[model samples]
Structure formats: C-alpha cells, structure tokens
Target: MSKFVIKDDFWELFPQAEIAVVVAKRIDNTEASAEPVRPDIIELLEKANEDAKKFITKDPLSENEVIAVWRDAFKKFKTKKGARCSIEALLKRVQKGKEVGCINPLVDLYNAVSLSFGLPCGGEDIDTFAGDMRLTVAEGGEPFLALGDEEYDEALPGEIIYKDDEGAVCRCWNWRDGQRTMLTEDTKNAFLIIESVDPGRSGDLRQAAQKLEELTVKFLGGTARIEFMNINKKEIPL
Candidate 1:
C-alpha cells in the first residue's frame, strides 16, 4: 500500500497550514467529457464561477485576501519565474468574466468546489503514481513533464512539490501538474488535494473537502474518504 506523506520541510514554513485529501475510488470520470457536456455539470460550474467573486473584493486581483496569502506563500520557497497557485489562476479567469470549461466529471466537480471555496485544489491519477507520494521541497532536477507539453520542465531546488518515486508529480507546489500523473477521463481512482495556508480559512477548508467528497460520489458513482492533515497528522494511506 502506498502512502501520502507531508514532509517536515513543508510544515516548518507554514505551521498552521492544513491539507485535505479526498481518496475517490471506483469512479467513472468519462461520462461528462464527451462532445456534449452534461447540463447539470455545466450549471454547477457556472454557479461556482459566480460564487468565486465573493473572495475577490480588491480591484487589483493580487490584493484580494485569498490571492495575497498564496502570493506571499510562494515567496517563501523557490518557484518558476511566473508560477502562481492554482486558485489564483482559477479566480483570475473568474475576474476576467471567463468561465472555466468542463474537463471531466471528476475535474469539473473539484474545480467547482475549488472556485466556490477560494482555495487551491488539485488531483492526480492514483494508479499512475510510481510509489509513495510526498508533499515536500524539491531537491532540484526531478523530472517533470507538464500536462499538454512535450518536454520536461525539471523542478528547481527548494521548490515545493508533490512527488512520487517516478519523479515530480506536481511542480512549484500547486502551480502545475505533471503529465505523468494528471487526471484523465479514463482514470478510475484519484487522489484529490485541497490546500489551505490561511489559518483563518480552516472552516472553508473543511466545507470544501466535504463538498468535493459529496460531488465525487454523487456524479461519478464512487466511494470517497476525506482525510485532514496538519503538523501532528502528517501521513495517511493512499
């Protein structure tokens, strides 16, 4: 059995931070990815886009509380020159009045929850992971083939990353996902991650996790278990 471990290196930076994991199994993520998107999923995503606006009160995007906290966190470690957290990317689209399109059932549901809660959320195909996965600072030179790209973008030393024995699964924290473990319509088992660095948003974090868990099983026909971790609870079976 593989395990997911959050290293001490990560906790040393943000002691109050918490990570929520939703292990979803036996799900069908392909139904909504066909040529025509499902109406219910579309409605869910549209509402989430509108709900995301509540977190962006500042005129300038970066000045918002949610975006600012992540920006400051990125500065604490080495990251790619222009890399930004996933939440920033999603909220920016909402700010521009651009709706995020549906990818797959599982991805769409998680994205909706992420946007609605204003937290960084991501996932990986559990079956694709090489071994035990970890959230830690990279040692640099770890292999990373970004999604939709043909080349490798190696991880930088001191960069926060989610990795398995094969190499980097996600580079620059949650900024990007590597193709090796990215979620696809064919994926049956998945590892979803909802990250919270702002201590004040702990309530939002739990709510987001619960929402994601409910959506996963409802739309995808699966069983999901939610796990929360902090400095004290650092590991869980994957």
Candidate 2:
C-alpha cells in the first residue's frame, strides 16, 4: 500500500556522501532479545530532555501485525494539548524529556529515534505528496504544522524537508501534516522521508523511519515508496 521515490535531482545534494539507503522492515521489536535498538538510535534518545524528550511514546507493535500506531495517538488530541514553543524551546527540553503523554506508532517512531540521534524526525502524507522534494536552510519565519490541521507560528525555515510539487511536505524540519495526510489503517501505499547532515551517523534514524514503513506495509497490506536522503552541508568537503 506504499511506494517511495528518490528523484535524480536529489542526488546532487549528496554526490560524494557515503550513505546507506537502509530499510528496517518493522518496529515491534519489544522482545528482550530482539534487535536491541541500534546504538546510535539510543545515543540520540539519550541526548534529549523536556518537551523534546516528550516526543517519544510507547506503542505495542509486533512484526506480524504493525497497524496504524497513530490511531492510538489520536486519543490524546482530546486533551487540548499542543506542540512545544519554537523549535528552540523543544530542543532545550528533550535532552532529558520524560514521556508526558502517549502518541501513535509513526509519531512514536520519529520521537523515539529523535531522542537517541539528536536529529529532528518528521513525515507527511505521501499520498498527498505532490512533487519532487528539496532541503534547504530555514528562513525562520516559515509557518509549520503543530499537529493535525493546526499550524504553528514558527519554523526552521532554513532547514530541509521533503517538499513536493506543493510548497512543503510538512514544515521543513519540524512537525508534520495532520491525520488527513498521515498514514492510516486504510493506507496501502506510503511515502517516507528521513534526513541528516552526516549520513555516517544517521543510519539508525534512517533505519527507524524504514521500520515504520515496513511495519505498515506488513499489517496494512500495502507497499511503500521510501526516500532516504543525506542532506550534505553545501560547505563541507568530501
């Protein structure tokens, strides 16, 4: 039910980068002996605190049946809770954020992997995705999605996101689209995105995103179009 594409245009951004287009099929690795979370993933999680730390959530997923993790997360929206202040506010706390609430699987994957990698993770409705994607430095004043259909007053505009034929897939590098575009129980095919500055240290975060995609395809009976990009620094040397 999902499919992903990495356009040729995107390759220009990582021409010399040694990156891995890794795919980790699913996220229900709860067994005591299952593949322990990748080391880098754990490291990233350990680096966050406060609201940033608040991103991770526990959702019971199994390899045989990885359904919509977000379905469970919707229940929290009823509390009238919202996103952290600016990205800066979120960064300040997640270095050691204790879980304050629950979230769905896709979100939990982003948050959990984020905690260990110290990298921001996000996604959008691939079904709603319109065109080619690009990543750039933030303009700072760009508007972003807080959750669901709500938008925030801020953004990391100079940063990067998987922009499609539409303006943005989500908001550059922060929060993402609402359930309207999010993957659901009915999703048969999906598009995914995960990025970073250095591909070497980013395998785990990349893998986590893949896991979410793979798990979805299994339980939901669809396919996926996964795009793992390494947004190299324009100034960095090979």
Q: Residue 40 in candidate 2 has what lDDT?
A: 37
Tell me the tens digit of each residue's lDDT in model 2 across 1-238.
2323433343543443322232323223232322243443344333433424333342321111111222222222221233321222234443234332224433444454444444445544444544433444334454444454554444443333334443444543334443334644333234444444343445655665666565444433234434444434321110
Return model 2's CA RMSD, one decimal.
12.9
Candidate 1's TM-score reads 0.97
lDDT tens per residue, model 1, 1-238: 8999999999998798999999999888887443344788789999999999999898889999999999999999999999999999999999899988888778888999999999999999999988899999999999999988998878999999999998999988999998888899999999999999998988999999999999888778779999999999999998
| After superposition, candidate 2 runs with Cα above 4 Å error | 1-97, 136-161, 175-180, 184-186, 199-227, 231-238
What are the lDDT figures for the candidates, one per model?
0.92, 0.38
Model 1 steric clash pairs: none
Best by lDDT: 1
TM-score of 2: 0.45
Give the best candidate by TM-score.
Answer: 1
Which stretches of model 1 miss by more than 4 angstroms? Answer: 32-37
